[model samples]
Target chain A: MKFEIMRDRLLDGLNDVTKAISSKTTIPILTGIKIDVTDNGVLLTGSDADITIQTFIPAEENGDQIINIIETGSIVLQARMFNEIVRKLPTNDVEIEVENEFQTHIRSGKTEFHLIGSDASEYPLLPKIDDENKFEIPADLLKAVIRETVFAVATSESRPVLTGVNWIIENDELICVATDSHRLARRKVKLENLPTDVDSIVIPGKSLNELNKILDETSNPVQIIMSNQQILFKTDHVLFFSRLLEGNYPDTSRLIPTEFKTNITLDGKTLLQAIDRASLVAREDRNNVVRFETLEDNAVKISSNSPEIGKVEEQIPVHSIDGDELVISFSAKYMMEALKAIDGQGQEVIVQFTGAMRPFILRQVNDDSILQLILPVRTY
Target chain B: MKFEIMRDRLLDGLNDVTKAISSKTTIPILTGIKIDVTDNGVLLTGSDADITIQTFIPAEENGDQIINIIETGSIVLQARMFNEIVRKLPTNDVEIEVENEFQTHIRSGKTEFHLIGSDASEYPLLPKIDDENKFEIPADLLKAVIRETVFAVATSESRPVLTGVNWIIENDELICVATDSHRLARRKVKLENLPTDVDSIVIPGKSLNELNKILDETSNPVQIIMSNQQILFKTDHVLFFSRLLEGNYPDTSRLIPTEFKTNITLDGKTLLQAIDRASLVAREDRNNVVRFETLEDNAVKISSNSPEIGKVEEQIPVHSIDGDELVISFSAKYMMEALKAIDGQGQEVIVQFTGAMRPFILRQVNDDSILQLILPVRTY
Candidate 1:
């Protein structure tokens, strides 16, 4: 196999696929990236057994010749070394050729590299999914949904299912939820094209994080297909596949409180900054807890006390306070993260407190699409 | 004590002094920053026993009132926490007051913090240095000298003296040298006014690193005073004191060879890029060895080989190659760093090779102010 391609075009394809390659994979061949040069384009594939990524570079892009193919074949080279070499190549044009016994030669400018390549036949086959059960969504919207909910997924593996974000689609509405039990993030979006058979699936938070990074903010459509065990997100030039968690996700619909004893509307940024200061002292405690109390004149007092360190209190004015006077304590980190996520949408945030011992919900003042719930700590 | 000072001005002082404060210090008081409110200004000091930094913020600067001092006293607060609180305060002006029981109150806008302060009298006293043994150098030049040599200092503490940079002053010339025995970096500058009694001193690499970060790139004069056990660096508003290492530095004067068999001149940036690419494959080897061989017509071949992985070779053009043809191998990392340091000054670099086993020297083509030496590895 021999081909000369534009260096930047090849580099872009390599960067996209290399994200799925892992050096820690037990399957040795999984650490290698597979390259196939066909008549139309060049395809690159990388996998780590759980996730696979494939990117393709067409021979011609916008009437510009991107690749000149002398022959067509396949080979798998070390992903990391190959990527680094391509990144540092001096010239814009690179030539790659595969000799007898899979000896791959890469040249650019006056620099040349000879890497021992493995036979492409040894690579594991990627799981196949039918395109019949697929739905399309804008790339930016999907990215936003992932960002709003992915951070709440449990990091620990004690309960394996909780390490993923649960996705449910029904009645043309798609809901994404992530919870570590202490806090939960939920985002719902209305969709026109829905897959009827796909009811629910739990995708590892790690997968969504990688996908979010790869997905551009453009409004281009991304087609998603779901199989029995594998899910694939297909963009214009790249295909991303991730394996689904085996266990059933816990039902979190009932965990959110609908009734509230007190409600307050305040600027998300102001409260975020105040809690950040209070957290300076509370961070020394095991729970990182801070107290919040409603006051007269549409204001709230936020404070944290540590006998060994000191105490901090800040009075933040709110837009309005109604229902009842209340005091509650919760993890400052949880509150801060929730406030940050809400602050991304709008400045005004409405916080509803059920009681001192129950969970509280924080959402945009007029938008119910995104909700952040935090369980209070009994600091008394 | 009570004072209201501009938040940014106080933050600048805190940032400078906090470089010396370490929470891991065995002496608890060393972890706290001592603040003294005097009629003239506010003094902030932080010390980790080995090094101390003090910065003063005057009451007025450029005819603007920077601080309003209501009273005068002193107290010690936790360095890390206080710095964070000040960084996040909302208002431009911050009020600090200490009560009779050492209860420190910090207020800005609607936020307030009460920290448990300690008596400043318990802080260790800084050693006094005589002004008779002092010299002044431009801050930018000093920072450049440190950057060029500090990276070559030995990181291992087995030979404590080698972990420091040796500064020698003689006949109005200041010479700085650092080496880990395998590689060495030396820089020299001529000065008009020099101290007569001060001969040589070894300053810890760690101390120089911190001082380099604190020093800004300006032509302002920095006064350096050498004492028996401590060295003081005095700037306009900051005083930095560091303890000297107690040991004799080895004489590296004889290690640098004046005679050479092969000389090659090349662009520093081009060689650096080529070496960076070659190191991609050589990095896996124990010594990170890359081979350099002179070619006909003022060209050289740079190559690295790892039997298990691959091989890389690049031909780099040079302006001229004089003397006998030579083949030598050295650590790619050392060569790259030396080239980078030289690239900071000029693009033209002259490389002198004595033999295959002898150390080689690299320096600017027309300047002798800085020199780098690297010992070759025996591959055969």
Candidate 2:
């Protein structure tokens, strides 16, 4: 294989695929990035058994030639070293050639490097998915949905299914939910071109996090294909594949409280800042719990006390307070993360309480599509 | 202690002193910052036993009232927590008051925190250094001196003194040297106001590193006073004290070879980049050794080889090569750091080589104040 390509264009492709490569993988060959050169374009693939990422660089982009092909072949090189070399190359143009016995030569400006390459045939083939079951979502919307719910997934692997976000599609509505038993986040979106064959899938939070980072905020459409064991997210030039978690996700529909004993609407930014200060002392405690109490004249107090670290209290005036006066305690970290995910800053959020021991839900004042629920700590 | 000070002003004082605070210290009290409120201003001090930093925020600066002192007293608060609280306070003006039983009240806007403060009398006292044995150096120059030599200090505690930079002052000349047996960096400056009594001292590299971060790149004079056991660096608003390493510094003067068999002058940046690329492969080897050999027509080749990782070679042209042809190998990391310290980019640097096994020295073509020496590795 021999080709001369623009250093920057090749570097972009390497960066995208390398996100899925792990040097610590037990499968030694998985640590190598497979490169295939053809008359059409160049493809780079990286995988770590659980996730695979492949990016393509076309021979020509727009009116400029991105790659000049001299021959067509394949080889796998050490992903880490190759990426670093390309990044530090001096000139914009780089020439790569695979000589006899898989000896790869990379040359740019006055610098040259020779790396031992493995036969690309040894790389695991990408899982094949019959394109019959696929759906399209705007990249930006998918990123937002992932951000809103992924953090709530359980980090512990005791229940592997809970470590993933559950995606359910029915009646032209796409609902994503993530929970760690202690707290839950749910986001609902209406889909126009919903595929009937695609019903429910569980994607690991780690995969969604990586996919979100790779997706741009552009409204470009991303086609998602689902197989029984693997899911693939395909963009214009990149394909990300993640293995689906096995097992059934818990039914969380009934866990959300529909009735409330007290309700309060307040500026989310103000409440978030106050809770942040309270957490300064609350974080010293095992539960990181902070107390919330309604005061007179549409005001509420946030306080936390650690016997050894002292106490903190802050008062914030709310827009309105209705129903019964209440006091509740919950983890400040959970509240903060939920508020941020909702983009609560500069917006009004309504909190509904269903007694001190029950779970409460928070959502934007007028938006019904997103909900954040947290189980209150048994502290007064 | 009661005072209403601008949050930003107080934060600046906290930041400067907190550089000396380390929670890992065995002395628990050292993790707290001592704040003393007097009629003149507020003083903040933090110590980690080996080093102490104190910053003063005056009541008035240039006719502007920065602090409103309501009462005069002192208290010690957890450095990390207090710094975080002050940083996140909402209002510009913050009120701090000491109530009964060492309960410190910090109030800003609608937020209030009562922290458990400790007795200030229990904090360690700052070392006393007499002003009679003192000299002055520009803050920016001192910072530069530290940067040039500090990285060469031995990190291992086998010879504790080698972990510090040795300073020698005589005949208005200030010379600082640091080495780890394999490589050495030396910088010299001519001082205008030299103190005869202060002949030599060794300041811990860690202390100098912290001091460098706190010192601004300004021409403001820094008064450096040397004592039997401690050295004090006093600025207008901050006082930094560092305990000196007690030991004799080995004489490195004879280690630098004046006679050379080969001499070459080249653009420092070009050579540095070539060496950097070579190090990419060299780093995989235990010694991180890169080979340099003179080539035809004033060109030199930089290369490194790791049997398991392949090889890298680059050729850099020189401005002049007047001496005999030579080949040598050295640590690429040491060479790159030395070049950066000398501000080698966009400047001509002269390299003098005595032989393949002897140490080589690099310096600016016309400047003799800074010299970097690297011992050659036996790799032929």
Q: Pick the candidate with the highest lDDT.
A: 2
Q: List, for all models, the DockQ compared with the true complex.
A: 0.86, 0.89
The residue ranges of model 2 lying beyond 4 angstroms of the native Cα positions read none
Listed for every candidate in order, the interface RMSD values in angstroms are 0.9, 0.8
* DockQ-based CAPRI category assigned to the predicted complex of candidate 1: high
Q: lDDT by residue for model 2 over A202-315, one digit each (tens)?
A: 999999999998999999999988877899999999999999999999999999999899999999999999999999999999989999999999999999999999999999
Give per-residue CA lDDT, model 2, range B240-334, as digits (tens): 99999999989999999999899999999999999999999999999999999999999999999999999999999999987889989999999
Task: Give the candidate number with the greatest TM-score.
Answer: 2
Model 1 TM-score, all chains together? 0.97
Report per-prediction Cα RMSD to one decimal: 1.6, 1.1
Best candidate (score: DockQ): 2
